[model samples]
Target: FKQAETSFNEALRIDPAFVAASAGKAELLEWQGEYSQGMSLLQPLLAAQTDDPAVLTVYARLLRRTGDAGKGMDVLQPLAESGRVSGAPLRQVRFTLGDLSDQLRRYDEAFCWYKLARQYRPNTFSAAAHRRFIDDLLLRFDSKSTQQLNRSGNNSTQPIFIVGMPRSGTSLTEQILAAHPDVFAAGERSHIGRIVQQIAPLRNPTRAVLARHAHAYLNGLGDSSRAAQRFTDKMPLNFLYLGWIAQLFPKARIVWCRRDPRDTGLSCFTTNFIDPALAFSDELEDIALYSNSCVELMAHWQNTLDLTIFELQYESLVREPESILRELLSVLEL
Candidate 1:
């Protein structure tokens, strides 16, 4: 974030009228959860660049974050309908509109905008390829193989992996857990994905390799509070690497967040995720296929892998937060 801010500032110093750099800075503030500061920066930019899709999109997102979805709708609706914007900018505008509509409970309008956004950025997610990948994981990491891998794993109970489909309440689950005095919420870490990429084709992973990767993952967590008994990695897509996680930290707690697939799919569709791995979220069919594949893989992990997995239902969490959270913490021994 510091490097990005420095780059944006340098660009602005060179060209003060660099609207893209200014917009980038404002967007960075939004990501940092500084809605008020982001809004202050964007308000002037929006006034000057009223028709600029980049400025308008960031401004609309800030408005939405500030509970002004109606105002956000008013701000973006005209630009979106003007057909003046195309490509990535248009897609962003449409997705922001979808988010605002969804926030306002205009479900049909939200879905329409989301569908339009997908048309702009076409995703080439092959379900067959994803299924094959999942099949390979299941075949390679069976009961016997995982048993051998477990012997070489780190015994640290500090790591808590919260895994599930995107928009499936992983963040909510993490927040609930992080509130505990003994737990530290690390948000979403891409360490596992990076490690898996480094050690690809895990058909016959050696014990030494598994041990080295496990150490690397723990080291990646860096320094946490000494008082923190558990640190969470709430990457929803980490469901893909649960088998590896089990082999890395056999004592680690896995919280599997489950939500109604329809709700999860709708949320994924409405939100504009910057991660390219989330390209599956572009199309509803792809989203459904990916969600089902994740479900299938998780079932295999639960059946074949010897790891503690606590299933936390989204509906249950929201409806009975206290009781459900108590049960969750108890399961994790927090």
Candidate 2:
């Protein structure tokens, strides 16, 4: 790490305006725990390259971590407003901004970031999933037909977030929903996760972030407000954030995607996700540990929250998608 920092610093000394070098140096500093100094370096780079997505993402992260939620949004709001952010950097910024907004209880802002992210590159595995997830949520928020589905006056924006380990067939279930005209497939939106991040610290997010985030998530769907009646975000790891989500959106449904442990471990090992939480990717035992953590967390979510999150095994989804879809629709009253 020290060696990398030295090298990045040397490069920056040689070309002070080098954005990559500056960003690299900032990263090393962050890794070294010198966050403020690292961020100081990033600020100049961001100023020098105002429209660079990478700068916006890293800077936003710095702001969020350092407890400056609004500033982080400020960094990306311009780019978001321009509608020009695209490619990999755009994804990075949007994801981080979404993440930060969740941490700060700005669900609306987080959804905007997530929606923008899905827009920039909806072809990637994660992106496509999230895009579909957001679309589903939007449909629920504006659907007048939901009167029949969630008849308890709790159906509007009510959702069943299917979360678990990746490669767990969350996508397959979403595909089934996509086949139905009334059910929209929001492949992997962060509605639940963002709610947890934003309001978890308050000890009671039920009255805080969940409703705000849901509203924002719905608003972020923009002009696609009339396609479906129910939205389903299927990011599996959302199990970790389920506790807070249930508290916030009591009407929100949950679906925990389960798979054979061995299969989940092997799949994670083979796939390369850049998220730091997946840091257990390089080792077998680490993967097992992380997997166990996920299971434990999901149990907590189920035990504590009043919400009903259905458990769907991946193998079942693969073998009997239609049946599972019918059962799922029955549960949602769709």
Candidate 3:
């Protein structure tokens, strides 16, 4: 975080009115959950860069997060309706407006905006290819195949992965676990997926290749992980790469968070992911289909692997946090 702050500061020092620098700093603050500070940073830039899609989107999101949804909606609706932007920026504005409308209980308007957002965004998610890949994965990683799988990496159980569908309590799960003295919170790492993309297609990736990739991932866990007993990688979509995770770190833990499917669907549909990786979340039926696919994949993992894939139900965890926390921590025996 110091590195991020220093970089942003240096950029701003070089040119105080640099919109990119301001937005980057504000985004860093938002990622750290410093909502008010993020809002303060973004508010000034909105006027300066009124048509800057990045600034407008981040500023509006901060406004919404800071309990100023009306203001946020006001800020986004004009740009979204202007038709002055296309591609990703237009999708962002529509999505932000959808989120603000959802918060305001304007469900019909929210749905309209969300649908438009999804339609306008690039079609990066290929359901057919994804299903074929997952099906092949299940076939390839069954009991016998997994037993013979390359177990050539470090055996250290220093990492705990939290994974599930978007809006499935992954963030909450990470927060509670990281609150413990022994746990370090390493927010979403896309490199894990990149590693899986690199290795999953191989007929057999050698041990050296696997070790190098695993080390690269571990290095991204950040400095706090060095002193902590267990660090979390709470990238929800990592559920898609469970086979690689199981193979790479056979002894490490994977915490799979679950929530009511309808609830998760609604939540995901209403929220703006601002990430292409979660393109499935943009559409309701798509998220549902993807969630069901995840269920099938998880069942495969549970039935086939000997790894500790703890299932944390969303409703139960929040309703009985103490009891749930006790049970959760017991898994680590921390």
Candidate 4:
């Protein structure tokens, strides 16, 4: 990671507005236990795009961890409405908020938030394992959804969705991208789920319904009273909604993160996630089956979407992060 950070810094020297470089460095710093510096760098970007569900979600988390509960809530308020990333981040936030609420003894509100977060992702694994497990499960979801998938997004905001199988390094890739001056990560908004929710009556929602939902969700997210522009979403499971995403946010960029099957599967199976949707948990065979399905799903998306999708390999990024990031940024035209 340090090596990658150095590479990113070099890239930024050539282009300061390089969002991926900045995001990569910031996330590296954060993971290295340099929260103060990481938050310092990310805060400005967040303020610029508080309406971004992904940015708000992560910023709110960092703020709460740094002992600014009130401010964190303030950041999260808007994004919570219609933003749609689920799995772990949502669960973690709700759990934190619930704990905070419990400390204040506001049990009811805490309960509601906890239930909501837990509604999708259960908490059975430690932090490290949770990330890995989700990767496998999300791919399973992606494989199925990517087949008949079709959805749209809010026209008001530009969405750059970062998705793929869990533990495929989507977070790492997003961090690199978000480091860029222009890119902001909205974190994981359940935009896909929100679309699904809106078209609940339809056995299968049309691409138009998905588009309307995406648009409505984004339109509702901006600070409005403030000025904020484009942002990114790292909902790995969003792969399931790619068909709709392509149709709705025609201009929205899609970054599909890829990782070695063995690594991803091992990571997924070894990790205990907070969600039960990952049917492969606790079973290596299940994980292997899921991984194969994910690769197949990716192939399907590439064939069906007819959209410009960027692919980033996790091993490649980890191996030569800056070079990979530069290529990724180039794809985003950053």
Report the error of model 2 at residue 170, Å: 1.0
In terms of lDDT, the best-performing candidate is 1
Regions of model 3 farther than 4 Å from truth: 19-68, 204-223
What RMSD does each model have against the real structure? 2.7, 18.5, 3.0, 16.0
Tens-digit lDDT track of model 1 for 181-221: 99988999999988778666665567788789888777777
What TM-score would each prediction reach against the true structure? 0.88, 0.51, 0.85, 0.53
Candidate 2's TM-score reads 0.51
lDDT of 2 by residue, 52-115 (tens): 6666667777787788878888777677667676676666766777777787898786766665
lDDT of 3 at 147: 80
Ten residues in sequence with the least summed lDDT for candidate 3: 42-51
Candidate 3 displacement at residue 215 in angstroms:
4.8
Order the candidate numbers by TM-score, best to worst.
Answer: 1, 3, 4, 2
Model 4 clashes, total count: 36
The C-alpha local distance difference test score for the whole of candidate 1 amounts to: 0.86
Query: Which runs in model 1 stand beyond 4 Å of their true positions?
Result: 1-16, 28-36, 46-49, 65-71, 103-105, 148-150, 200-202, 225-227
lDDT of 3 by residue, 1-334 (tens): 9999999999999999898898889878888889888878776766555577778888888888888889988877888777788987787788888888888889999889878877875667778888898889898888888887786477878889899988899999998888899998889878888888788778667788888887888887778798999988898988888888877787889899999999999888767676877777766667888999999999999998878999999999979999988988999767
TM-score of 1: 0.88
